[model samples]
Target: MASRDEVECWLTDMDGVLVHENHALPGAAALLQQWQDQGKPFLVLTNNSIFTPRDLSARLRSSGLDVPEEFIWTSALATADFLKSQVPGGSAFVIGEAGITTALHEAGFIMTETDPDYVVVGETRNYSFEAITKAIRLIVNGARFIVTNPDATGPSADGPLPATGAIAALITKATGKEPYVVGKPNPMMFRSAMNRIGAHSENTAMIGDRMDTDIVAGIEAGLHTILVLTGISDQAEIERYPFRPDEILQGVHELVENDPFLAEIND
Candidate 1:
């Protein structure tokens, strides 16, 4: 376990730990500001691949959070980074929004549908049947299937919406190929974020709400994990999971009160 004074970096889930229901969670903004004031490196991680980092940063700022674009990491970015490492300048048939498209482009991947190297799927509000059909055809043509995340559903103002994992399942059923998911619970996403910030797992801390995705990934990545109750998992649900977080808090407010970054502040 990493001590409070030993933590030199922070990796946190964006939706649940920092903001929920389009509002910043209690003490989220203050804790983030404190991290910045103390020059602690941090990144806000998310499995949602609908929006680009800039778009997510704007959303957070509007909701009273102050995370910058560079501090935000998405599953799309992780997928792109992984693809780039495997096959540089590859072509992909993508079925996602600006987030996936932008990340792939920046990573030197060419977006194509004419016998591409990969069929990449991410979250999108416009999950068109035509696009899915194309992705199926591409996978059938020997293109590798990749998905941003394995989350079956995502939260919304209305209700839960079918996410990338659900859509990836449909594609898998049609093509008889399982997608390589690169998101939370995979640990690849966490390791990629750690590499991005040049932080070691022993000195980094992770905060999240979901025990399945966030906490499990953190544990696997060898980081101290804190599970907050502001999002998906509640106290009762946590008991069902065999894994556990290093600490549990009601919200970021409690974390602020505890002052995990006190050593940095004092320094």
Candidate 2:
């Protein structure tokens, strides 16, 4: 693993590493601002496909984070990029919110339900039975199955809500076909973000809270990984995974206070 001085680019998970339940962790914004002031390349990778980057930026700002839309990369955008690469100007039967649809549109994909090239799914509160049935039938009728992420459940004020993975499972059972997951743990999204930022993998570092998704993906992408214990996984849970992060911290606060490279910026 490379030291902090080797990090020329940074990628961090949004939901946990920087914020928890719509609240910013201590020093999260300051750390991001420091990176920005240093002209560092960084991106906030998120699996939430319910909102576009613009919408998410507003939400994060409301919670006291100063991230801009351009600095945010969502699974929806990655999925759209994948689809565009696979079939340029193809159509899709989408079961998602404005995030997914907007990305597809931007990628030159026409949205349809009848004999589309793909059946794309993402996070949405309005997961209707009709939509699922249509998606299943579309897949069975030869449309390829694609989902934004493999997250079975998403954090919510009311508790865990059935996410894209859970809904994708139902459609898989109905059509006897699985979906191509395009978010974290796949490494493709990370590669895309790195490319978008024009950063080499070896010079990048990923800071996240989850071992399964964020850390694993970072390792797979050949980037240094840092796990923070502000959200899902903790020190005790780190032993459960065969793969490990390059470093672990209490939270983003530690990075701001202790990282030598960041210290230079602060000084």
lDDT of 1: 0.91
Off by over 4 Å in 2: 257-267
- TM-score of candidate 2 on Cα atoms, chains taken together: 0.95
Per-prediction TM-score, please? 0.94, 0.95
Tens digits of per-residue lDDT, candidate 2, 1-267, equal 568789989999998788887888877977998898888999999998889999999999999998999999999999999999999999999999999999999999999877899999999989999999999888988999999999999777789888999999999999999899999989999999998899999899999989999999999999999999988897779999999999998888777745554465568
Candidate 1 C-alpha lDDT tens digits along 117-225: 9999999989999999999998998999999999898777799999899999999999899999999999999999999999999899999999999999999999999
Least accurate 10 contiguous residues by lDDT in model 2 = 257-266
State in Å the error of residue 179, model 2: 0.7
Candidate 2's displacement at residue 236, Å, is 2.0
> What does candidate 1 score on TM?
0.94
* Clashing pairs for predicted structure model 2, backbone only: none
Candidate 1, 87: how far from true, in Å?
0.5
